[model samples]
Target: MMLIKRIAVALALWFTAGMTPLKAETTLLFNVFVPRSNNFHEVTAQWAEEVKAATNGEVTIQFTAGNMAPPPEQLEAVKSGVFDIAFIANIFLKNKAPLLQATMLPWLVDKSENASIALWRVYKKHIEPKAPFPDAHLLTLFHWEGGQLASITDTKINDIKELKSRKMWALPGPPADLLKTLGMSPVATPAVQVGEMVSRKIVSGYMGIAPEIARDFKAGPYTKTITWFPRSVTSTSFSVFMNQEKWNTLSDKNKEAIMSVSGEHFAAMAGAASNKEMQAALDEMKKNGVEIVPANPDFYKKMQAAAQPQFDAMRKEGERLGVNVDAMLEDFIKESESIK
Candidate 1:
């Protein structure tokens, strides 16, 4: 009878052990450019939700948005592990990532979706694990869509010549560089300050997509015309980077699951969201009486001609770094044309 009791007790312990749940939890802090309801917000949230559900609640994300911290500081903050994830512009991080500047060169890409996909393909295939972003794992890299010109001070700027020497609120980084090339004096300012700057007559115009102007900046009182310059397309390549330590700690299965939905796949979703927002914002702008101007054929040709030298110079820089920039750019353009 003792022997029987011993066996029964052992079986009961085994059953209890088998029935116990194994809990795996990971927490991520994500940051973005605007509030929770914005286009970018929707894209990031969707990605987080999909990952969480796929992992059966094993992963959780906490998000913070707005220019709460300066844009340029985001990558370094993530590299230092202050935040597990951040959405940062390729241009803002240009100091750390010079090659990335090649992708952002003026008029190099025709569509945000194409540029985003091509850039992600190139980064995954070549960059990322090499140096600058070695401390973090790239989640996604996408570009914003359809940047246009809008003004609060002056009503109209008919041609590129008219844009020359106009005081405009620059979006900083490459846009500043692009505007300067067009002979416009860029008044360096943060996106949040655009409304106040316009109201105070500090800037004659603002350069950005309509959604940013209408939704984020609430651009109305200080503005009049929305010029459809489409000058130097303002698609920002953004990434949701995971701290390297955290990424390494994850199970291979979990990592694969996360990656399955990230990188190029994530970029597509983000690109689509940005495009939708741009369209919606333009529609909203029209309703609000903002004038939309299109670039004349001559203006388009001139802008393209001006940007070619910049592109060639970047290719030379790539060769010095031992990267085939011509191949990269060719691949980018080829794939861009193939995408749609």
Candidate 2:
């Protein structure tokens, strides 16, 4: 009788276990290429929290603490499943994502928010159909605020003629190209090294950087004046994406939840955060006695003219890709202006 009782109890326990449902949980590995204190990284952490909330804890993101790969290798890292998600600078993928260069063109959009939103809308309408980066799932696109020219020398840039023969550090691509075309000796420099380059007097000034960059990179002390353009000279573009296989593993419900906090929403959030930082940085730079000089009308016009060849080149490339580059540009500008 005792043996029968023991068997009955075992059967009951087994039945109870079988009736209970198993919990499903997923954690995605996120590769952070930027510094932990950077605005972009902070915003991304918030985005991860939103995703978790939206999924009711079914999905979560785990940051890798530091970069898992080089900046240019991030896309491939995600595609190969080394990381489930990564932040990729579009400039590095110029050969594969040429159309993305539109966001980096001279005198385009002024605010980061507007530029990001416009890029997403235009990309969906025009560039998406081209099947760029078919190996990964793009979550959203974003760009930094327009960059201004900063000079360390006493002679501020009041006219385009003043820029002639002056060695200036610029971010590679359109910014450097435009500076070179305008008769300035352009040296390609990374943001982190700008302060060192300046202190060493390697260059007279630097272009294609925002005020926040100057503040964070410790370039303010060496920077005497900033030549502000109504529409910034150029900006850098970035894309947040996930591995195709990992994205496919997500249930439809979870996928929807994740996307709810992505796309244009993510873009706007990132831009607004950066804008706030930019304002604070500007205030700090002013306290340090860095003068903000407005660009002369003739100088601005000259810059626009020098950028014409860049636009033309983009159009030619668009023709090869069967995309109407003009339409995309018009839509991007219109969408950007329409936003507040």
Candidate 3:
């Protein structure tokens, strides 16, 4: 009787020990560089909630808003494990991620959602094997709605000739280069400085930003007309990535859960949110008496012709990076168009 009782007690103890949870919960620290009100930040918070639910509480995210590092330094912070996750603007990675520059070419994609998903697809198919960010695990890629041309002047840009010698603020990289090629004295400055520049009359107009950005940055009030392009003059691309060590700490199940809500799904979510915000901003701009007009058809043709060199430059650089630039570009356009 004594032996039987001892055996039963040992069995119970073993069973209870075996049934106990094997892993403690994991909480990842996310550093948000952009303002909390920004669409990317809002969507990231939503993504965190989705990750927690998807992992059944095994994994969670905590956000520390405000810049932990400058925009250009965010990737290095994650690489060194200062933060578990970050959304990095591709412009900052120009040297390390040359292939991704393809996303920034002018007039390539019309809609944000389509462009975002297409970016992810192309990255996976062409850029992934190249291992662009070996130190960080990429979660997703995304772009904002197409950027438009807005000027403080009342006259719409009806002729390409009008742009000659005109001073304008342009987003850095290809957009700025394109503006320069068109004979504009382009100031390639950060978006945060745009409002002050505009108010001080530092530039006559700006290009390569969505409507929401112009509004949020207080540049809309001084603007007289926004020239809508059938496709954007240029668009910015962003990447959400995790520290490699932090990612490796996650169990396979939790990793799968995180990725399930990432990639194309996350891109689409961010893009859709951006589209909503953009439309609202445009509406507000109209209500505030800003005129929104389409680019003149002849001007559009000339602009496209000018953009050819940009496309060529990107292809040349992509080829140097060993990417099948032609095929990749073709795929991206096809996928983007097919999404709608």
Candidate 4:
């Protein structure tokens, strides 16, 4: 009887061992709104690869680009578990994440990598608790170096005055405000439509990245001039968001794996890619005889002056949102400058 009992137990243990492991593999769904060549899309792919390698394939990410969801709808989709992961551009969530606007106040950081680090630090410290990512877990924050004005018109945007007479395309939030303050009529146009709008005479020019402009507007055909500016002019803020429920279910080992490649590191990676893409587009513009015009210091000073009130308003809004705007601004800039 003893020999039979021992043999039965050994058999059961051996069979169960082969049938099940302790951890189930997980593959997360990553949603992107742009094409593979797009900077953000490229970064997302890298992030997924890093996470998978770090986890030894315990976890993986399946990317579904092609506008799986629009920016405005991303917040709710993430919270509702429509996507396990998504990137939310801050511009689309003004009412939802009002406090985050502080980091985006133009002219804060000079480089995309700098802005990316600053945003990650600030969000973790100040905005995460009060900000509305609505049922999502904040992963990382990043931004491009800065955006500039590009025109298809015969006249160049050498100064604010040139912008005044032009019907300029603007996105929501600070970009629209900056142009309006500088005396340009801000026409709210979807990025996909910028090329068509310019061709049809709906807008004289636009304030965005050269890469984005070339992608949508085929700048070589329509753009005769490109304008560059500093942080005081414009930048974009984007955050990596995951459904809270999904995040909670991740094992500690897997959590660490995902986060291992996130934060400031991810920010720098994405920002650098964006900067490279911008430079490439500018080079193409030059080859096509599109005049690449650097905004003179005179123009910069004028824009800084014109942009002051907008900054003030952003600070006031920050205060109303219960954050100490002045102090946050100083800290944000300090963190940005402190990063090499």
Candidate lDDT scores, in order, read 0.71, 0.88, 0.87, 0.75
lDDT of 2 at 336: 90
Q: Candidate 3, 150: how far from true, in Å?
A: 1.4
| Candidate 1 TM-score versus the reference | 0.83
**What is candidate 1's local distance difference test score?**
0.71
Q: Please write out the lDDT profile of model 4 over residues 1-340, one tens digit for every residue.
A: 9999999999999999899667578888878876666778778888988998988888899976456677778878878777788887777877777766666666665777877887787777776655545568877878875666788887888876677878888765677777777666687766666677778888888775445545545545788887766553567778788888888998998898889898888988988887787678767777878887778889878877776887788777777767777777787889878878
Best by TM-score: 2
Model 4 accuracy (lDDT, Cα): 0.75
Q: Please give each candidate's TM-score.
A: 0.83, 0.94, 0.92, 0.87
Worst 10 residues of 2 by lDDT: 157-166
User: For model 3, how does the per-residue alpha-carbon lDDT over 1-340 read when each residue is reduced to its tens digit?
Assistant: 9999999999999999889567689999999898778877789889999999999988989998567888888889999988899988888888888788787888887888999999999999998886466579999999888787888887766567766646889888777888877776688888878898899999888888888989998898998889888999888888989999889989999999999999999999988888899999999999989998888899888888888887888788877778888899899999999997
For residues 125-161, could you state the per-residue lDDT of candidate 2 as single tens digits?
A: 9999974655799999988877899889999976777
Instruction: Give candidate 4 regions above 4 Å deviation.
Output: 1-22, 129-133
